[model samples]
Target: MTRSANEYLKRILLSPVYDVAVNSDLQKLDKLSASLGNDIWLKREDQQPVKSFKLRGAYNKICQLSDAQLAKGLVASSAGNHAQGVAYSAKKKGVKATIVMPATAPDIKVEAVRNFGGEFVDVVLHGTSFEQAKEEALRLSKEFGYTMVAPFDDEDVIVGQGTIARELLEQNPDLDTLFIAVGGGGLISGISVFLKQLKPDLKIIAVESDESACLQAAMLAGKPVPLEHVGIFADGVAVKIIGEEPFRLCQQYVDEVITVNTDEICAAIKDIFDDTRVIAEPAGALSIAGIRKYLRTNPMQGKKFGGILCGANINFHTLRYVSERCELGEQKEAVIAVKIPERKGAFRAFCELLGGRAITEFNYRYSTDREAHIFVGIKLREGRQELAQLTESLGSNGYNSFDLSENEMAKLHVRYMVGGRPPSLLNEKLFSFEFPEYPGALMKFLDTLGERWNITLFHYRNHGAAEGLVLAGFDIQDTERGEFDQHLAKLGYIYQEQTDNPAYKFFLSDVNGVFEK
Candidate 1:
């Protein structure tokens, strides 16, 4: 059913969501503003009691329920935040509810649903995916006369999410552009409809994940369509299809829809942490990611921009993945595979040619007699342009290199597997060293010892810590061990010999593989 502009506005204004959800701050992101050359504000939806804006719509829908309908109980299907929203609302209303979550839902979220609802909500672990759980929820709703509280499809829920726009204008009326993350479209639909009607000149931009861009697909088709597959990274907004009503409202009011990749989302997460000290989930950071991408192409200045930090219910392990990709996403890091000469001082010369650029990672092994391919990760000062210039420098220096910055396979799997068995045994000794992370640390290490030894294997990675770590293998005769110890003592860096480390012997070293009777 199509809702009139005034109808949505009146409903949003009259929404009783304040009974539960707080008026989250529209805080200014000073750091982001200075960096982006724009006045940036983040609507703090993550401040909600359930740590997400989902509670607003869920509670609003539950409030508008008839007394008779409340007696029949409520049912809803969600994989994460929305389930918690419905559970929170149901518990507050003292009504019986059944939340159908996918069997594969994280244990933390499943327990949270039970904890939030207490005895009021019954949780059913249904199928492997949201679609399967949703099917089961629908069946229960039809068969047992339970009312379905959809995540984003219904009118009351849309009005609930729309109230964000009401508070946004009140907090910052001078905003030139607003960025809202889109999933099933209820959030953007409500915001766009209300904001566009009241402030016709206000630009409403919709942000979406590239993996499951249902709204973009809907816009192309002029209707809501199901995606063939949806990525689970941004699970909060991983709706396979755009809701029918949301598509209608968005088609009319949204100025533009932009999609961002996984790396950009990770970068946005880090940006939010840097400015607000809040680690947002992937979906929560979508608005900020979109804003950055839009400004990159449009290149505007001194304009006010607002984005919704929609949720902060992040799984802790996900932070590991976020940290690894954030630099690449911001174009501040580049990964490459380069073939350098296999000689005693080749690595030292290569480091000298880098002109003081810090390497984030390096991995190599003794492979060929003449040349060896090394995987390298370097921190960039000027993003892609700097990377291009570095590549040119490598080529000019007679080193063949392939940029693996954009290679998923290279980033995910191959980087860790860069070390393997050498073609033959070469009196090698493995050692791990720790040096204070400071200016010219790499050069200090190279100058201290590398020129005197033939380095057979090397692995180094920076983890943003106070110390830099390196695992190095050197081709040294048994008689040089005492001299090597003296050189190491003069270097004044902490070192540990790892020649007998079991894991290295089991996987990386071939001393056990080379057979001799």
Candidate 2:
């Protein structure tokens, strides 16, 4: 028989063992509410023991297993939190649990799963993706007689997730909407059914990363479709396909599914960190991203809304990329990739055109094209129109430019492309200096150079430190070596001239310290 939403609600109401879940708080989001001009609340499932709502589902599912099934043991696959949830629940119920997780899963998650007493079957690095790992888990389950405890598809799991709704309504009965991150549609499916049954008019908005939007794709395709590729950044919710059971519930109960970019999700993570001093993993912070987009089109008119921070399992190496993109997403920083001729006077003219914006990164390369191209990064003004004028002026100066404001590749690796040029000649010069933190350091640096020789490459970082570092590359005109020496002496700053160093490589090398190797 097909399970009904009513049945899930009955399970929550009747299950005495699950009453503890009813105590989790539905918190008023004072800051987000003020920002959106709406009363926003958060179902703080991150406060749970496993640091996510996953525990609820795992506990519910494991508790409902028959004695024979429990004796047979259970297994599940997850990148992080789901594994911990299942492990914690199985240990509590005296059930033998074996978890299958990707080899790339975070060290903390792996440790946490072990801490919960779940035996881990470390599989061979078979698949390059999470879905393949999941398939392997299913195969192992069938072959080993272990019950497959799905992360989000089973009725018991949905009921466990729905318990969050029970707690949420008990605390804030007037909530008009709830935002929940959708991975395989388990959490949102459960919450949607519970919330819809309790308050028929309450809005359920499903938030997902655009690159890993399985539920949204499933809804649009009218069935579960395997995604050709899934983003690994939001590891927690980077599901390739929606669970068949949860998709049906989402279709019936979820009001809408909204997609957000990885950049937006990272920005939301930063926002949460700023407000609550809490560091959320990418998937954990995605629900707020939907609420932000929702406020753009629909004013809440002071109606109450809430979002759940689902899980935190971000990789440490990935944080740097997320930080850079989040700054761009919030418009606090800007990156531009421009191609300028490697000729005298052209470099100076381009720099002079950037009257007010600072230079964040300036690097050059010898392109295969006739003209050597240089990529200069500029900091944009706070006002959008001011930034537009700066780029327009760049275009006017016989240079072709592309904004890396939303480009993932450029932010991750292209900003450090400054070491491809051949060694400087006798008359060439290089200087590194610390400039005072200011609004127009780039423009000032150009003014100081005074339209002299061609600038071969430059790199600067304005990271709110005591001072910013500026590295400039110049092609000297037919001047003597004495003039170049005098120029460096006049600057009176600690510096290095790497033109003669054998460490120079055609591409970015470790010796140059220009790019991330």
Candidate 3:
């Protein structure tokens, strides 16, 4: 008998399937490539009517089956893409396809399978995850006399997926790299084999979301290893363990594997829409995100590379989060925690410091003492650093501050609560400054705000040292210039006019153009 490994390689090499699963026309992505600062192309597997590259493997595998096997029908399990592929392929081959999908699978996916004439068995959604659904599917396939079509582990499936590499090379003979999203590693395995045979110099990079980096983790362990936990954020590539065969093929033919965080993948999704006007599910854009990250760190410069936008089966609601998080990842946004003493004039004084920034969220936390924590979400200026220096200026006058950007739970919940007693006295001053970010920016500001005024409210967090937003309030007996502008000017910090309008009420009924209470 032919070695399964060799047979798989030959079968994929001879797949009578589409001459190529990924073509050059489909490979080029103007939007995806431009972000890389290189000539990058996208193998548009998402363009498939089924909305994924899964069809390549599904059809190729089924076509190679004997007539008797086809007559016996096929059984498969999938949450989305693979299910669509098997259903579509079975309909094309005039075979019955029974798909066992968890009740939790997206309704859209179930509909698509039904549209392709695949019978759906809605199983008990008792399992904690999709992999459990597959286990049930496997047991049912055996009981029902149905041949199982493994999504990415089977030799036939790998060969079919390899067809993508064959076509990609044919389209761009000069292409130096190919980025494929890894789940069970079938796509990478097939492409690695074909690409290495045709072009030994081609760099095959596998992109996997960190949550489901089964193949990458396996390679690291030198064997298939299951994840104790997996994040379903990118469902398509969320495999617990990479198939043993695919792993061996990967160890032999794959060049490199990389993982991307969910945030990074979300950023890439927005980037793709900005370029291609197309929305890709997180899993579909995994390779594109990886390639973008690679070129960002490696500088492809004038080289040509290819990324596969493999699927578009995203749930519509996820796009909202993907867009919002992408903006945050780009540093165009931030949520801040502001500390202010419970004082009358302090709130108004701090309001004056917000010049160019737009407020997005404002919440107050209640406290028994005179001081309280204020959570505020604000748009950051293009080039701002940590908030400490700004807080230092306020601190000198009596304000102490800390950043909540690193506190995930605070950003999620605490940011919305605002509680504190009303101030009875009014003695505070407010001012905004642009200061040089240095080793002692905060301490210097503290010295400058002087020891006379007690700080009431303060908000500043450094992202880097270039520049930062400073919102602070000080309890000063008088509104005289004193060391206010002097210290700022000495440090090359500018006193910026923030709020001068008559419509907004001042926290401190101060007595000046920019301050007094």
Candidate 4:
């Protein structure tokens, strides 16, 4: 090991994190272990006072600060758990803290920061993301002469997070593999450094959300690089770039980095609840999701594997979306788009083909004169392979079907906008829109559009996040197209015209008949 690696390991061994952070449990997940045919364990960092592992690093760093630095107070930027950690640590140290958080952060987290710090911390809601909030925090630190505490990247913070590795080794020394979620790479970097030093053969699998796999991208580029965009469903780990120090450590010690989709993360959350009766945040559940994915292709029967349940600070409102996607994530639900004849008994015949299988969702609309398109979701009691066999059976029975389980557009938008375009609609345009989600936001949107143009089709669904997605169609004369464009521009909502989207053409367009086999 390098000198820096040795220093990190030593710091972890002597970390003062236990002053404020508990030694979280390392409990066996019996249900998951039995199902996967492996001995699964959960490192329950979610059980911490702040409900996240971030407290370990935050408290350790704060406790180590010089008396002069503490007297000047502290400043940091974070959207959720990190903010809470800093706030809690500052309160414990009797130091004033200023936390800059994204304005779009969940209300639960913003309130938690206030509760943790009480009179010792000031909460500043600024910008739309953590990066923007970080800039604001830096400015505040300069203005107030406060010490800036980084959420990750600093040696002290990395060493503090490494404490988990020490506990894991002491708790279960014979584990074959450990799955750790990566964000800015702090947790995994710290843990991998310590674990690899102690047990050279132990596999350290770094897990990340597919939408925000910055560490994976960094590894591929051989250096840290920023991602242009990242999904915020797993907002806790939605870092656009990995920290340089953490990246270096991960490169040297991490055995592999893998990404999991949103559905898989939700399913993992469900799995955790099934075993422990605790619901973990999407990022927290990512490690178990990675383990589940790995076991599918590489079944290691009876081998001991560990996963970190890094946090449990989930927004209560987001549970609806998590529950809805968990089934699909577990491959226990299959969404399909099908074409059927426009006769009276077509629906009955379609049900007969399903052969008593539970129908989760069914949406249909008559588009053309001779055929109709139906968006259906089937409950898969047998497993993922059953969907393929069912689709094949439908095709052999003369029903044209399209598997939409993996279609992003279908899952996010098209399924909700199933009504066919009207033949009488002339010069019609279809558009998908995204806007900040709040009460009456939809009404405000409609008011901005005015009553000038006829609305041909409209669809909206709330996923209980910061933003709302909408699909709409409008009928306007070519002469009035310029006015429509002006209205769209003035509305200030993010939108993309989807009149030519393939999914729309397949399911909603009047000109396109049932797809040819």
Candidate 5:
């Protein structure tokens, strides 16, 4: 174990990170501080030229390479941020750079790398994941004479990341705790070594996504271990294994390791946006989410805490999922599945029980003669306790309800699959529509359609974009085709008929002749 805090301190001091990286601001988070009753500060590394802290380490490592190595150029593999970092650094150093990225990487990130590196970077999309891309990069490095740039494992990279801690301690010397997001563990390992040696009393906490928690796993086993499966939602920090060097540093200097779920990450994104008016990638928001959870469990009041806002290279399409889950993540919404009698007044009675809190989502289909299962989402004002009370109230009123708030299957799949084909429906036509996303746009759509035709099935989800996607089924006979066409023209929305879509046929079609409505 060649883990020397003093040696790391010297390396950090001499690190050439500043040549290509910004000394990011340490901004005070007033709203978060007021809510938690503590002094909260954010290390805004997301404001870097690459829109991530990765440039510091990448540039530092590249600058340290021998003249021969620089002349040969460099090769690296990254999911997104590190690729951008390497590309930008290589462009600045006037070296040829080849970045191999996962085919699954977002288009925005790939395009940014090309634009940032200009004539210096060659981006190759080869594999479906980072690990595979990394393997290809290594193969190419051997095949050619290009030097390989490790994303987070190398000593120079770790030292470069440590520079953040130097800035943090200088900016806010009174911090009691620091929260850092951990993937391959470079950032936390670097920060922990520097801060622990400098301020022995300061707490260093490592935050990781529960789906890809290699750091927590390594800490438990006392060695780096490969995770069998990793979630890709927070693709920036979705490492399957911790680096050996980073693991050793973390084992020695990191105070604690904690994991947060997808919802918590989404909620943290919302929190950051509220304060900084900036949306963070899920991985970037991991530290803030961990901080919130720590405050909940530890209840430290009036203490100084700092969280690193690591990166902000989020894909635009992912905002819809983040927005939809944020409310549930904050415990401000509860999704429940209820079984009500198929009679007409059961839905009305269930609404009465709800008492007008707010309906975020409601999906139902008459699938059976005796009972109908409805998936409903209600806006929560109080918290989880309100959800519990609502569940009890439903039972007392003779409605059978199952809380789906914590059910991952329900949230991701079943909610959208709420309406399957029923046995009695006649002349059902499925159509897809896109409307300008705005307040009351859905209501306007429904109002314009009116009660002229019975709605058999409907699905609409807001993806936090310019337009909203909707799938609808209506009972329209061939005789009423002309009238339906006129209604669509009057609505003036982009529409497509998906009645024959294979996905609908396989999963939603009442193939057993069970249609009864």
Candidate 6:
């Protein structure tokens, strides 16, 4: 549909989202502004009734429903925030709501949905993915006559989200730029459409988690397309494809779309906590991450900048992972694997060569008396520059080193598991797999992957997300290569071969004749 920006503007002005949703404060980030040398402001959408701006869209969509439609009730599917929004809105309108959430949806979110709706909503734990849960919701809406309240694709929903833009302009009429987090694109579509229409020169930059940048993909493809793979660390914005309407609106109004990695999101999360004492979910902090990135390249002085803390429904355990990686995101730490001699005092000599720089981490397990591979982390004062200098310094001193700071596999799997060299060459093939996180998922994976092959090495970590990331190794003979290929094809999970990955070669696997072990 060709969305009329003016119509959205009119509806936004008249939106009744405030009935259940609060007009969250437009707070100034005094500390962030001072530190970044820019006037940064954050719209506290995390302060909404459901702790998300999603409540606005859900409530508005419900309000637009006719009395008969309301009586028929509504059905919606979401991994988190939208489910709570629909449930809360349904309760306010005295209508029944069936919220279908993936089985892997955060327990806190599921419980919050039930609490907000009281007896007015039924929480159905559906399939392992949003797509599956969404399919069930659609089936129920069609066959059972429930009104389907789309999470981000409907007109009333767009109007509801546009209310944020209305509030933003009102709060800071002279705001120079706005950074918005894009998932399905509803939030940015509404905000960008409204802001661009009102202030033609207002810059609207969309931010996305690099793992699931469906909007950025849409901008490239010129249409919404599904991403073959998507990471879910920032589950809130982990959409595989942008909504059709959202994509259309974004194509018209969005000036630029930038993607941030998990580390950057973690850094932004810390920045938000430091300034506002508010713990933003990974997706909630994307705007701040994007703002920092934009300023790094397009340096500005005292420019009025605005961003939204879209939600704060963070899983508690996730804070641990965030704490560990945030320093890397800020370029305050660098990890490198170095080859040091196994001779006595070799470790001490390496540390001394650094001139007493603080060591953040060091991992080494003696495998051979000839040489050793040491995984080391050191603080950085000049970010990547310092890292380059350190690497060069190590090379000049006859120490071979590899920078694994930007290597995803190294940071995620190898760092924690630095000591697992096969006893002998077992013809092992390493693979990194991503699968839906649910009960028995690991066992199921083992069942399918290890039934015919000998398991060699395995590493898995859960960051309180919808998916589990596993790095597994299997021993396969050359004669079984065809069968192994067939097995991998039969397994539908997303995966990438890591046999040649430097992290694995240096730390986990039996490589070369020398055994970098």
- How do the predictions measure up, each by TM-score? 0.81, 0.74, 0.72, 0.92, 0.82, 0.97
lDDT of each: 0.86, 0.70, 0.68, 0.88, 0.85, 0.89
Worst-scoring 10-residue span by lDDT in model 1 = 508-517
Residues 159-209 of candidate 2 have per-residue lDDT tens digits of 888777777887888877788998888888887887888799988889999
Best model number under lDDT: 6
lDDT of 6 by residue, 1-517 (tens): 5657788889999999889877788888888899789999999999988999999999999999999999999999999999999999999999999999999998999999999999999999999999999999999999989999998988889889989998888889999889999999889999988999889899999999999999999889999999987888999998888999988899999989999999999999999999899999999999999998888788879899999999999999899999989989988899988888889999998998786678999999675777888899999887888888888888888788888878899999999998768777789998999988887988887776756788888899988888889998888898998989888888898899988888788887787323232
Candidate 4 regions exceeding 4 Å error are: 1-3, 425-458, 472-502, 514-517
Off by over 4 Å in 2: 15-22, 118-128, 299-301, 339-359, 364-386, 393-400, 418-517
- Model 4 CA lDDT for position 273: 99
lDDT of 3: 0.68
Per model, state how many residue pairs clash. 0, 4, 28, 0, 9, 0
**Which candidate's TM-score is highest?**
6
Q: Cα deviation of 245 in candidate 5 (Å)?
A: 0.2
TM-score of 1: 0.81
Candidate 4 per-residue lDDT over residues 1-517, each given as its tens digit: 3448788888899999888889889999999999899999999998899999999989988988999999999999999999999999999889999999887788999999999999999999887667889999999989989999898888788888999999999999999999999999889999999999999999999999998999999999999999977776898899999999999999999988889998899899999999999999999999999999989878679899999999999989889889978999999998988889999999999999998999999999886578888989999987778988998999999888878777666787787777756665367688888765556878977887688889877888877676677888888788898988998998877787877766676786655663533
- Cα lDDT tens digits, model 5, 429-496, are 88877665456778977887688999887888765433456778888989999999898888877677
Q: Which segments of model 5 are wrong by more than 4 Å?
A: 1-3, 421-517
Can you give the lDDT of residue 180 in candidate 6? Answer: 96
Clashing pairs in 1: none
Candidate no. 3 TM-score: 0.72
* Candidate 1 Cα deviation (angstroms), residue 468: 31
Candidate 4: 10-residue stretch with minimal lDDT: 508-517
